[model samples]
Target chain A: MSRVGVVAIRRGIRVSIYLPIAELSVNMIILLAMGGAVGFLSGMFGVGGGFLITPLLIFYNIPPAVAVATGANQVIASSFSGALAHFKRGTVDIKLGMVLLAGGVAGSSVGVYVFALLRALGQLDLIVSLLYVVFLGTIGALMMWESIGALRKAGKGGSTTLKKPGQHNWVHRLPLKVRFRASKLFVSVIPVLGLGAFIGFLASIMGVGGGFIMVPAMIYLLKVPTNVVIGTSLFQIVFVAAFTTIVHASTNQTVDVVLAFLLMLGGVAGAQYGAKVGQRLRGEQLRALLAGLVLIVAIRLAVDLFVRPADVYSLAPGVL
Target chain B: MKRCARKHALAVIGMLLAVAVGGPSAFAQDQGEPPRETINIGLSTEVVAITPDFSGADLTIFGSLENPDPQILRQGRYDIIVVLEGPLRPVVVRRKDRIFGLWINVDSETFSSVPVSYSVAMTRAPQDITDAKSYKQLSLGIDNIHLRPAGENADPSKTEEFGLALRSLKQRSGLYNERVGSLTFIGSNLFRASLALPANVPVGTHRARAFLFRNGSFIDEASDQLMIVKSGTEASIYRAANTYGFFYGVFAVILAVITGWIGRIVFKRD
Candidate 1:
């Protein structure tokens, strides 16, 4: 009997579902729970959950290629759902989003090309794990430090309002200035487009919606108004992630639709309850908790990279 | 003297039975010098459909031997080996090396044609049935399957290493398997062989071959083809993904959009 069959027989339940592209059987309940848990975290922190979901799937033993591609596909659902709410609230800056998308499209195309090259070279898995470790480690540490500082300040009876530093920065001095009326800011289109392109490249390579990086880049570097930051980021992410999904599907044929659909089903439903719970928690505490979680995942991936694998030899289809 | 008489009586009874069932051919063969032995195998189904919940299954192949010498058959010198080989496909085997404190795939070797799966069932242990040279010549066992390296001028040592790795990996994955003593003779000339088909059996045209041997010397062989195919919606989805990838991708996006839209409508919180 196959391993899945043995497991099914042992458990006395019929919860395993076959993934077409991945060509494997996985427990449905486990996938659903994973999606729901990541969705809960995303809703709680107001961040796109792609960063979390991709690694989680990898930890669950899904092939890196399938996980990365399917993660991008799953991101579309949550981003679209979030963007709709922002659109209704009139917080999305259409002009700004459009400019960002132009750069995002170009960057995503190049990223897909590189992705295919690495896969053929058999370096894709290593590169994906390394990138995840670096990004998650840095972001998690920074979030942890910042949240801890905030918590300490609150404990000392001080106002915890986040300080907005000098409005003019090196980013503001770049050429090709443009005005975004909704954001109420005049900024160089060069920095805006560059940032978007950078995030788009990461989105394709890392299988993330790029919100974790994009949100901070917008707030600190571009100095976009806080209200419009998330809305505009989601608007751009919805398009970039969508493009990444299509390109990956066409180029790599790695996207598992069954896997993506399962994740979306659990994610959308879990987000509602997560949002409710999020409202009750303090922002600093939530940030600190999320940071810890991110660091743990990063550490786990890093350990795998350092530790010896069970088998040094592996097989793949097709001739080199 | 009594034992010899009983043996003669049994052989006569066997000869009469063969003549009665094996027809005029048996009579002609009996009149002539001992006839050459032949083997014939039959599969109940030509196409094996794999459903969504398909697990591994045992495939039984029935065969019969013609004009077998009763004395050799009673002595158990006759042995049969049956093999079910999946379609051949190109494969690459990669070896990982530690570089900069990380395990990374540094070298790979490719084979032009390798069976996706190989399942063997033999009357006895491989070593007991035939010599290593004979097995290699016939390519009868898992280790003996010829794995041709893809490119020319490949290092012989490396090719051998990769070939070994390929066989070991396939065996570990249950795709290449062996079942000794699974081929059993029910009558003097009738036998049955059972081969295990893995759950992840590649969907393709597989060849089931039965080899007949007398006293460890090759006599005859027969083969039949069986098609293993994915049935129902799963097969359609697999075909769509490979054939119309772009449209499939668009459909995936549309499905996601609909699911998200439904989620928002069903659980409206904002």
Candidate 2:
């Protein structure tokens, strides 16, 4: 019997595995390696790796829907493990995290609804790519700018201390103030909830844990202590990502457990080593490197949008 | 229609049997009014179970032509076409147009009840066996398969464009395919056809249809059902995902949590 179809048989041994929900066979080692690479980056940056994983999966030709949903699923594992470490260190602000979780849940619900709407409208891929380009470009550019300034200061033998948190911003003047004992600050619930909701929305749509956005927002916007920021952001991300995964699975039925599992296994293992390596690097240098990586991804996605596709037409499973 | 075809096939088989037992004189006497030719196909297995590592396989369909004309068979005037058509489902075809330096989906058309996959094997080139008119009438070839736009009043030109796009996309993906000269005569009466089942073949009930053409004219046609399904664990996973999505979602989350916990324990350094 002659074998035929998309997967061409190579001369050497190849370990291919089938993803049930994705409905395709992919090289197992390639998936694991992708997970490990993203996991390493996330560990070094003290962020969830969902932002990297979703786009990588898309590049590998996994359907955007499956890639997004499964990315959310994979984020839960890394964030949960990271959160556990933070919990042990007693750095996570549980009260602040809970409030953020509340807003995240609500925002995720709306995001999932919109995701389905966009998918049905046959604009999901475009919207997803567009969003990635916008967010990644903005964040990467900002990080690069900030870190370069810090690097220049250090080069001149000046202390690269972070800005004093007590300096009040307009966000501090907002109403509905809430006190979080762990972070030792008084902050408005309005911005906290809104920020959580915004990240949650992006998490559901982009299949990210939102840590890349959440950590910075906590430190710069909410004025949360830097010591507690990573832990608290991760705490909320764990639950938010969990919530997004369940909803996407139940509503869209797009989550592939097999794919998620492979990613998670490789991720958690790689993260530990990444964290060790991260500790040896200076904060400014790490930020600069991460910014460069993010910008490259953004530029690649932008190129795809601008370049003519191989085919002008595409097919979807359902009627529009 | 299937029952009628089956009856015709039985009659052809009965006549062939009578001629076999009644000797040369019996066949000579029956030649004055030649019996109608009929086609029948049998699959080696009723269902094809795809394992996890399944790449692709050739599905051999054994068939026979009853009451075939001796002269037509000898002269290679008889031709057979076998098609394995996947289950029907609605499909949307979208066209991307350049908008502000970005290619975005600007137009789309929906086609209902479109076959998910169509694989055809023939005794000869489709054009060599029959005229285009006959092929279109019978809907025997890929181009001949009718695609109906979901909207009743869709633009004819747009609908045709989308329909062509859909066919080419399916062909590019190996879901819709054709293999010329894949059917061969085993002897004088029996023929075998090999249809390539692509690795990405959709799991559902597929129809195996055989069309007979003698001297470039349409003759009898017959079809049988074949089930293509994922086997064991893969089958259960697919079913569970579609059927009990809520529980599956919960399970997925729990599995992730456990994996995370275990990873920390095994590789714990802190």
Candidate 3:
């Protein structure tokens, strides 16, 4: 029998394919569906969808190591697709992305080393879970509050104040300034690089693309244009996630190529449809919806941590 | 599911019948006035092929007791325990403790030569069939499996606790299984046991050992080797990832980039 042929047992139940790296058999249909859903949300919200996909994979009982590594692999496809769209529209700030990527590369190396230490101590899962709770909770709540205010102002016929491109903030006061033409801003490179590196580190640890954190940071802290922020962050994310994948592959050997392929197959197609659907929604409503989703995911993670677990003792393969 | 199970049952029966017909003369050689205890065992599948669609599999072990007196058999003079053990590897078991309102892994133990998967089916419980000492010596039950600490001078009691925790975790994941009264007697002197291999069963040369106990005493044993291997695309991918991991990672990234670029071009409207 051909290896790839559908395995139908006597009971008419189609057997699932095994993922070598994950060491589990998963239904292809389920993975495809998950990838499609996450990709659609990613395209619509201008987020990498890593925040959602990582937790979801864990929920399905995938090993956290495999999930995190493969999650980075899946993010690359969607981020690349989104970045391309932004590039065509001339919204991507290549200089800003390059600056961010430089820091991200260094940060990811450190993150991978730290991840190995945590895994040795058997604390990687706890740390990853806590990270999701803290970052997702804070970011989600803040975004919800901001979007709600925006919606209220729009409802009351009050125009929201937009920050001027050349407005001098404490960030601009720092030395090592650089001009990003697409963003229409002259900002100190220190904070920008530092922000990118910090997010990259978290992304490596948490198995996320870090676009959720990068988007808001650029908008509020760096004062970059909203149109350019998404594209630039995505551009940086492609490199960060790609670098993370290679690091994980060579170091941990945790990347499941089959699982990543199944997810990316659905993700690429779903992203296209999601972008089309996104055009119908207003900016404030989309932000509000995205905030709600982020909050929901955060709450679920909190529940996992706080609630009593069914099994308190866990067994993991020996760390090298 | 029922049909599949039935099919598997029929296949196992057919194989056993073939073996029984071919081996009767060997059994007759041992026949005597005082029927001696003997076991003839064969596995339905000598080699398990793990194709890409290998979710899991069921292997049937069938055997016959040669020259068993009817009265002795009626009095339950024989007990059989069949154990299927996968390849061994090192494993770490962690225990979570509530510390300052949060559950954290505070203690961990590492052990070498731990079976990745194990399943035992017996005619009766180990306690009922044999003494505790023999059970431990033979590794007849999950608790009795030997898991030595990996190069550490650890406390025996602490290691025992960790071993229990490891066994519990593996059992929950369906990696370690123990089933009593699962070895069914098809007819007089003919017995069969079915082992269900989980999807996560490690790939290696595994051994299935069947032990026959008579009146709470170890009598005879039979062992057979079963090779579990990854075949086709699964094998290729696994081989490449391990041998050429760097190139594999690069290929993965490039594949994603190309797919993403193509997705935009094909789907873009206006």
Top candidate on TM-score is 1
What lDDT does the true structure give each of the candidates? 0.88, 0.88, 0.82
Residue B190 of model 1, lDDT score: 86
Better DockQ candidate (2, 3):
2
Predicted complexes: DockQ each = 0.69, 0.70, 0.44
Model 1 per-residue lDDT tens digits across residues A222-273? 8988999999999999899889988988888888899999999999988877
A1-320 in candidate 3: lDDT tens per residue? Answer: 21123334312556366787886667788889889998888778777899999998988778888889889988998899888778888889999999999999888989988988898899988898889989989988887887889889999998755434555568878999899898898988999889989977987898899988898789878999888998899999999999999988888777888889888888887877777788888777888898899889888987887777777788877853
- Interface RMSD, all candidates in order, equals 1.1, 1.2, 2.1
Q: What's the CA error at residue B169 for candidate 1, in Å?
A: 1.2
lDDT of 2 by residue, A249-275 (tens): 899999999999999998998898888
Residue A261's lDDT within candidate 3 is 85
- In model 1, the Cα lDDT at residue A222 comes to 87
Worst ten-residue run, lDDT, model 3 chain B? Answer: B26-35
Model 3 agreement with the true structure over B1-270: per-residue lDDT tens digits: 663354344443333443554355433442222324577788777777877665567668998876553444677868899999999888988888887677888988889889999989999877899999998888778888999988559889889899998988888767899888889888777899978786567789898989988778887888988898888877788878888888888888898888778777777654
* Range of the 10 consecutive residues with the lowest summed lDDT in candidate 1 chain A: A1-10
Q: Rank the candidates by lDDT, best first.
A: 2, 1, 3
User: Between 1 and 3, whose TM-score is larger?
Assistant: 1
lDDT of 1 by residue, B1-270 (tens): 663454455555456767744445556654324455689999989999998667688999999888766767789999999999999999989999999999999999989999999999999999889899999999889999998889988999999999999999999888999999999998668899989998789999999999988888888999999999998776787788888888888888888888878888888756
